[model samples]
Target: MSGSHLHSHDHAHGHVPVHSHGPASPHPAQAAPWSILRMTVVSRLAAAVAVSAAMWAVVWLSMR
Candidate 1:
């Protein structure tokens, strides 16, 4: 077999090499009113705070 076998189908199909297909929409999050970005951030923050409180409770109980 030759090195040509290692080549991608993009060239064979006369298609340009695309490194990235960027966001579908310029303002992806804002494009959709029900976008999960805001909810995701809020959930993550709430989880962090809950985890920290749980850890502190554990430490307090251990020290008592």
Candidate 2:
């Protein structure tokens, strides 16, 4: 209780102790851009319904 009236609380104590906080980042990978534009509009609407069912199966096999 006396050594030149000691006082230095190790820099006033408690200054840095965070398992997660600002100033130590490097954890990114949470895809988020409207889920890649909704998977590119559902793969261009399934390639425009498979090119309109292959052009309606070549116009119904050229009307047989």
Candidate 3:
């Protein structure tokens, strides 16, 4: 028999290590900072304004 046959291929191969550090975290939304949410809203608003400005520019140029 080969030396590789000595290796275990039963429950040892499917073992998952457990980890615990005190307690789990709270709700994801509650954990998130307000600045991140504000940045997202501001970015979306800026994008909408930019798109409207571009459309307006196109229409104004076409009127010439």
Candidate 4:
């Protein structure tokens, strides 16, 4: 076959195997107490709603 010569060593496809020693480290944002990454889903939704309300109020006041 045309591709019969491709079967050689294990890394013939140009990708080296990776090994993990232990658990992965947490993301930087998750490590901060005041970061949004630490916020729960409900809290994030509430924050979004509060911001939207504030924006609409500002626009309404400016248009009056």
Candidate 5:
């Protein structure tokens, strides 16, 4: 082995690879209107509440 310290350095120590797809749009100009967005949110919330109420009713009836 050579006494020089230059050839003793390691190459597999610190190396990182980065990957990227593309940029995303925050809000496109052709996006849905505010009224439609409001209706969608309201319907989802209503459905979730209905499901919870139905589950509670079922459990209460079973325990009675």
Candidate 6:
């Protein structure tokens, strides 16, 4: 998330830098633990699969 405002490329003309335009989004990286945990299914494979399926169902319904 870094950039140069006035650099070689823009030096030729005139370039302006910009920052994130809107509200900061929840970083997907921060959710890595829960997401990974959800993916893991050694002893709880059945429950994990069920939860995943339900999540998909909700997402599909909401999208529709």
Query: TM-score winner among the candidates?
Result: 4
Write the residue-wise lDDT of candidate 2 on 1-64 in tens digits: 5658666566756676654535667655676756535667778789789999999999999999
Q: How far does residue 47 in candidate 2 sit from its true spot (Å)? A: 2.4
The candidate 4 region of ten consecutive residues with least summed lDDT is: 21-30
Query: How well does each candidate superpose onto the true structure, as a TM-score?
Result: 0.39, 0.24, 0.39, 0.49, 0.39, 0.34
CA deviation > 4 Å runs, candidate 5: 1-39
lDDT of 3 by residue, 7-43 (tens): 7656667676554442475434445554535577779
Candidate 2 residue spans exceeding 4 A from truth: 1-37, 49-51
**Over all chains combined, what TM-score does candidate 2 have?**
0.24
How do the residues 1-64 of candidate 5 rate in per-residue lDDT, one tens digit apiece? 4785665667887776543432463533555555535667778789789999999999999999
Q: In lDDT terms, how accurate is model 1?
A: 0.72
Residue 57 local lDDT, model 4: 100
Model 3 off-target regions past 4 Å?
Answer: 1-39
Q: Over all chains combined, what TM-score does candidate 5 have?
A: 0.39
Work out how many backbone clashes candidate 2 has. Answer: 0
Location of the lowest summed lDDT over 10 successive residues in candidate 1 = 21-30
Q: How many Å off is the CA of 5 in candidate 6?
A: 56
* Candidate with more favorable, higher TM-score: 1 or 6: 1
lDDT of each: 0.72, 0.75, 0.72, 0.79, 0.72, 0.67
| C-alpha RMSD between model 2 and the true structure | 18.8
Which ranges of candidate 6 are over 4 A from the true structure?
1-43
lDDT of 1 by residue, 29-63 (tens): 33666544567877878978999999999999999
